[model samples]
Target: MSEFQKVVLSREITGVPVAQDFAIEAMARPEIAEGELLVKNAFLSLDPYIGSRLKGRHMSGPAPKIGELIPGLAVGEVLESRAAGFAPGDHVVGESGWRTHCVMDAAAAQKVDAAIQPLSLHLGVCGMPGLTAWASAHHLAKVREGDRVLVSSATGPVGGTVGQLARIKGATKVVGLAGSDTKCRTVEREYGFDLCINYKDADWTDQLAAALPDGITVYHDNVGGDVLDAALANLADYGRVILCGLISQYNLPEGERPAGPNPGVYILKRAQLSGLVVYDYMAEQADYAARAFEWIESGDLRYVEDRAEGLAATPELFAKLMHGDNVGKTVVALGNG
Candidate 1:
């Protein structure tokens, strides 16, 4: 009870990470200082950005050194607090890292609604991923009535939310491209996308072309490789592209990364490309969550999660995510202790 377990980056990683890339080690529980709270992390948010951060490419913050706890978002209960307005049992979400316990400054701890049925949601559909989807769709992409939308990684927390919200926003057609047929089904049946194309199929490009007879008006891109190229080729005039996540190249070294997608089409189509970094809209999280709550309750928005239990499972689950095997949000439950 006086110690904590954490997953630390154990070795330098150049490609997709494996369980061996991380080591679970125990450390003495430190006392909280003023304006700090000792949190018992209930869940760990596994993201591709964590991998990007270790390599010093992620823009959210600097890269963590080897042997340091992997820096990422988490939500947990405050077991002890030295800060005002936070007490034991209150729920909070922040960059708590991959640990069973973490000492966080109160200013860094954004308390969340303790009333949410599963607090883990604050790390998923109702959390950062949700905000990322909403902000880009509404503010950056300007998705509106009569627009045709296409989303890649369609079953993920970000992509799934984007497609559904585009539908709710009066988009004329909302199509998604997922890696597998199973994921494609989840995109359409669960997330309610108009059509979900399996990009792995031999004739997927033709399928995508058939699905978007009028071309895409808003393309919410997550995987930025051939997917982006295909979407670009099928873009309508004045098409908007939201660069929410470029997971396809996350594993490659800078020099080994692929070349740019077709640029000629951008000029010909008058394409609008914008990168959507979620941190820029942290100030508006509460507003997005409020609307998300209504949409969830009204059955207008939907999401799924691929979760594992305990700190030991975090690394493997993340590896699965990098392999494109996860259907939705990737999370690891560490317990209330």
Candidate 2:
């Protein structure tokens, strides 16, 4: 293995990412030292957080530096190992960025049981998206049986899992807000959301209120701006709001946010608003995965992936995800011509 392909960010992105923002080229796969393994990337994540990287800001986590390979989380298989405790043909997941080949320390990744499920599941249901949902539902939101829960970006990876997990956790009604009518229908019919509203409709907020007669007790916020405003008004007393991602605000030009919403709502309703950084809860990742694995094994949880076929598609898929073009997790697959 001399070299393989990688997608490198060429410039800071201003708007919807164009092809010129990324360039894919071959580079030598560096030799692994002791305690390291060379992996062939399998699935590259295209998440909303990547949008923040393009703007040179750090909203929740570390910012990506310019001229670096755009950072990402992915799953891959070890092709060669010079490290202890790893061998050729072992699958692992980590922050390997967007690349066809990677050399990482063994401690940075945990071996994946490929036989238990499709390896791609490590990038979706059993991975960050799933854990994000679990943390929002159980830890941040404290959802309870008979609680009315609402989620925005409902067709995307985080929102999709949030709605389903709410149902499993015994929420009486799970209302979802999605970009399109098709996504709304999928949320209702496929993900078991009691009501799914299309954000494209001007009357979406009115529709959401009508559907949630009991008032929303837990809101998993993925989209911000007007949607967040509406959810705020509909929350019941003692409501819990879990701030996940603000996809709508991620790509806005500087100084674009208008002052809106009073902070007094939290005091008025005695609501608890929480902001979460998933990495802070890493200690519980294994426990979260164990529970999610049980749900997956018993067919109680469902997942979807929007897969792009090659390393060349990473940047394109990243833009697509920011534009809400993908349902569930967006991934770029590498390997096997």
Highest lDDT model number: 1
Off by over 4 Å in 1: 1-3
Task: Evaluate model 1: give its lDDT.
Answer: 0.87
| Worst lDDT 10-window in candidate 2 | 56-65
Task: State each candidate's clash count.
Answer: 0, 1
Off by over 4 Å in 2: 1-3, 59-67, 254-260
TM-score of each: 0.95, 0.92
Could you tell me the lDDT of residue 174 within candidate 2?
Answer: 88
Clashes in model 2: which pairs? 35-83
In the range 5-31, model 2's lDDT, one tens digit per residue, is: 777878767777766788787788668
For residues 185-274, write the lDDT of model 1, one tens digit per residue.
Answer: 999899988899999999999999999999899999988888899999999999999988878878778556677776888899999999
